[model samples]
Target chain A: MRDTYQEQLDELASGLADMCDDVARAMARATTALLEADLQLAEQVISEDIKIDDVRAAAEHRAFGLLALQAPVATDLRVVVAAIHGAGDIERMGDLALHVAQAARRRHPQTVLPDEVKSYFAEMGRVGVELAEKAGRVIRTRDLDAANELEADDDAVDDIHQHMFTVLMDRNWTHGVSAAVDVALLARFYERYADHAVAVARRIVYVVTGQMPGPLAV
Target chain B: MRDTYQEQLDELASGLADMCDDVARAMARATTALLEADLQLAEQVISEDIKIDDVRAAAEHRAFGLLALQAPVATDLRVVVAAIHGAGDIERMGDLALHVAQAARRRHPQTVLPDEVKSYFAEMGRVGVELAEKAGRVIRTRDLDAANELEADDDAVDDIHQHMFTVLMDRNWTHGVSAAVDVALLARFYERYADHAVAVARRIVYVVTGQMPGPLAV
Candidate 1:
């Protein structure tokens, strides 16, 4: 029974890693769709979000089942609980990715990003994908070193977010109100996506250290 | 022993309700701070968010305890799990409220919203508080009817959100990109706060009816 319980916990961790992999792909594709104006890719990313949800639901089911049947205590209990909460954060990261895809789809045939901030978004997208991939690694390995790196990764996203604002607020910015709104919203989506990724990493760190990480700086 | 378990479950529910109450108050105060540009009120809301976090941590601890000790099954298991997840959503709602407060505080003596959309934000503030209060009732009563009402309540928030966008997109909007960015971000904060409240209600409805609601229309 103890061996079976340990196996189930391993499965829960793997399921979360798989969900993170899916989310990472979605973020990558969503950014590509945004930059290249690929509506098909955007739609694909949006539709596949359901798969991430399914993975999360399964993880929650397994964790709850373990709680009900095994009644894991101490470290085991913490792992199961963190699995449930970490799955939630991952699921939300998927939602944020979908938002990015939808924004790309809604602005189809026209680039959602104004030309001025195009390169900035490209850099943001790169860092966003890197963060999601790193998040997957942290969940799979629970390496405190890798988990701690997410903060710096998210800080890069924030810097770009701040830069996006600076560009919008610049006197040279000629984009109309509509484009400005689009740009602002897009930057926010990316920034928030990074935040959720960091939150997931922090949850893993908490499970390892038993020191509760405070809320992400939203 | 069964009676003791039942009492623990009751405590979990009460703790969650108390957390909801604190979050509701934070949202209300954050909105007032924004509307009045009351830095003190904003700062108070910002600081009080930590208290909400503490409430959530305690609630999670209680729920985890029940899960480990009593090994609740069936409906009991579902309720405990929901408490954990629901507390998370409520805590996030508090974070969103904190974001609102931070926006107001950052703007300091200068008002964040442009003059044209002032009344619109006022309406949003009123609706935000009403939604949070109603959310508390839905959680406390577990009334499917009350829970279902949150979707329509969120619709009201979405309407204001759309109106804000329309105003921003209007050619008549003379506010520079800075004010426009501020307004866009503020609108998003309220919109997401409403979405989280609706999500909490949906979780209750799920526990009651077992019908899963799809993602929020972000």
Candidate 2:
């Protein structure tokens, strides 16, 4: 019974790692949809978000079952609780990616990113995917160093977010108010996607080290 | 020992109720600060947010202790787990309010909302505070009717959010890109604040009914 319980716990962790990969793919495709005005890709991302949510529900259900049946104590208890928390954050990351995809679909037949700011989003998308992948690795390996790297990558995403705002507010910007709003919101989606990835990594750190680094920068 | 465990569980619920009140007050003050350009009030909201976080930490610690020492199962276990999840959502509500306060401070003495949009924000603020208070009531009483009402109030917030966007995107919108960006972000903060409040209420319903509310509308 104890060995089977251990496997359940292991499965929960790997399940979350897989979720991180799912959201990474969703974000990468959403970015492509936004850049290329590919309505087909955007629709695919929007429809497929359910798979991520299903994975989250399964992870949470498994964690709940473990807690109820095994009543794990000490480190094991923390692992289960952290799994619940990590699943929520990862699910939210998928939702953010879905929002990005929806934005792409909303502007179908007309690309969302103005040329001047497209490169910033491209970089944000690349870094955001990298952060999600690193988060997956961190969950699977419990490597504290790898977990720490997510923070730096998140910072890079924030920098690009700010730079995008600069381009939007620049005197040369010709995009009207509607387009500016779209860009602002899209940038926000990428920034929050990275933040959630970092949040997942932080949960893993807490599970392993028994210390929750610090309160996330507001 | 059993009696003490019951009391600890009760305390966790009340702690979360108090947190709802704290965030409600913070959101109220944040709205005032934004509308009045009151730098002092904005700063108060910003600094006082730590108190909310502290309350959250205490609540989680108590819940964890219950799980570890009491090893509660069935309904008792759900209560403790729901407390953990509810505490997280409430803490995020405080953060969203803090973001509103920060937006207010960023444009101190120069109101964030222009003349035409002031009334819309005023309505959003009123509805947002009402939702938080109702959420607190639902937490303390487990009143499913009140919990259901939160969904309606959240809809009102969403409506105002859409209205604000309409104003921003109107052909006559004279606010330049910077101000438009500020309004867009501020609207998002209020909308998200209301959403988190509703999330807390939904957790209460789940604890009572044993069914999670249909996944939050996106």
Instruction: Report the number of the highest-lDDT candidate.
Output: 2
lDDT per residue for candidate 2 within A105-217, as digits (tens), equals: 99889998888788889999999999999999999999999999999999999999988888888998898888999999999989998998888888888889888888854
Give the Å error, residue A129, model 1: 1.5
lDDT of 1 at B130: 75
C-alpha lDDT of residue B13 in model 1: 79
Give per-residue lDDT, candidate 2, residue B163: 87
Give the worst 10-residue stretch by lDDT in candidate 1 chain B.
B209-218
Query: Looking at candidate 1, what is the lDDT of residue A164?
Result: 82
Best candidate according to DockQ: 2
Model 1 interface DockQ: 0.66
Residue A217: error of model 2 in Å? 4.7
DockQ of 2: 0.73
Give the alpha carbon lDDT tens digit for every residue of A87-113 in model 1. 888888888889889988998899898
TM-score for each model:
0.94, 0.97
Docking class of predicted structure 2:
medium
